[model samples]
Target: MSNDFYTSSILPYAAIIIKICRAYTNTQEDFEDYYQEVCLQIWRSNENFRGQSEWSTWIYRLTLNVCLTLLKKNSKHHVTSNHLPDVVAEDNRTFDDESLNHLYNAIKQLSEVDRAVILLYLEEKTYQEIAEIIGTNPNNIGVRVKRIKERLKKILDGKVN
Candidate 1:
């Protein structure tokens, strides 16, 4: 990727990529790998974009697809572990907000498709936008978002086993 293009095209949209990668990954190392792969994939696949949608929307779909694909591949080769290790912060630092941590931990428990839906929802994407991205009906997106929200609330409240 050219430095200028990356700075202009990818850097501006990196937050969406990072958040999706973070939601799908349990550890920092895995997060870095997924993030790298997403960036590389976006660069490799940019030419295929036909400009039918906004750039941000295209990036969102690309990021989600890459993360989900890598996740599925990893699950097949690795034994599933119930416990996620504590994420060690760089320079021995920690995030300032506890609720954010709780939220992300809860988000991590959602099914892959639900995770993508909720992430897009949290990003304030419209139901139609989410539907377009996920290839579902707009009406279904509302119902799914409602259900996912309720499930997340239960998880946060310690009601869901």
Candidate 2:
């Protein structure tokens, strides 16, 4: 994509990128690294976009794939982060809401695929849209989402780990 297209996409898509990357990362440093890597992948794959879906949907798939890829790669070399998880947004101004932080923390506890499902569901993507992005059947999303929501509730309520 052209510089202008990427630039414009970055601003509008910043929240999606941040939330997805943040969910997969445990520290501020790792979050920043994931964010940069996701953006880099977008830049590298500029020519591969086939316009078969909306730009936002395409971006969602790209962000999720990049994060998932990096997440798996890190597992082979996993090291505990020195930084505290709640301390992640201390220096960042955008996601400072207390409840948002709690929700994100709870989200981080979910299985990776469940995290992606809930993130897309929260974005208000239709079941079909989410299914397309995640390569699952549309009907499966509804059932998974229902389950994920219940799991998130239990996590938030301090009843489950």
Candidate 3:
């Protein structure tokens, strides 16, 4: 498929893509590498997209699958925040954004499956849709999201002090 496919279809979601990449990988280089890999994978698999879901949802599944597979195969070297560009901390003010970042950081501490659920939840995905993509029941997603929210709030409250 031509690059235009991504330019038109997937490029609009780059920020979410980047956030997901950063949430998984620590270093800028590693994140970029993984982001490129995701793009390539999406492009390669574009033709096979059977229109079973929204394109973004499909991309999210592909991204989660790719990142989880990579994580299972190789553990990335943990990097301190100093190594990342300052922008990682940008958009990180305001109670909600700060709370969201804290929540994201805490969510990163969970298993890959949990992390995916939290990310989808933060993205405002419905439990049914999240369940559909992750192959879990909607009821379980509801419970998991509630637990994730409580965990995030605890982390946020701790950081506020």
Q: Tell me, by TM-score, which candidate is best.
A: 1
Residue 141, candidate 2: C-alpha displacement in angstroms: 0.6
Positional deviation of 21 in candidate 2, in angstroms?
A: 0.6
Stretches of candidate 3 off by over 4 Å are 76-100, 159-161
Best-to-worst TM-score order = 1, 2, 3
Task: Please give the clash total of every predicted structure, in order.
Answer: 0, 0, 0
Q: How high is each candidate's TM-score?
A: 0.91, 0.88, 0.78
Better of 1 and 3 by TM-score: 1
lDDT of 1 by residue, 7-94 (tens): 9889999988988998888777888999999889989999999999988899999999999999989999987643343453222121
Model 2 scores a C-alpha lDDT of 0.84
Residue lDDT tens for model 3, 23-115? 776556767788888999998888899998988888888888888877665555443331223455444321366656655556555667887
Ranked candidates, highest lDDT first: 1, 2, 3
Overall lDDT per candidate, in order of appearance: 0.84, 0.84, 0.74
Error of 3 at 133 (Å): 1.7
Clashing pairs in 3: none
* Candidate 3 global TM-score: 0.78
The worst-scoring run of ten residues by lDDT in candidate 3 lies at: 77-86
Error of 1 at 11 (Å): 0.8
lDDT of 2 by residue, 45-91 (tens): 86799999998899999999999999889987976442235555344
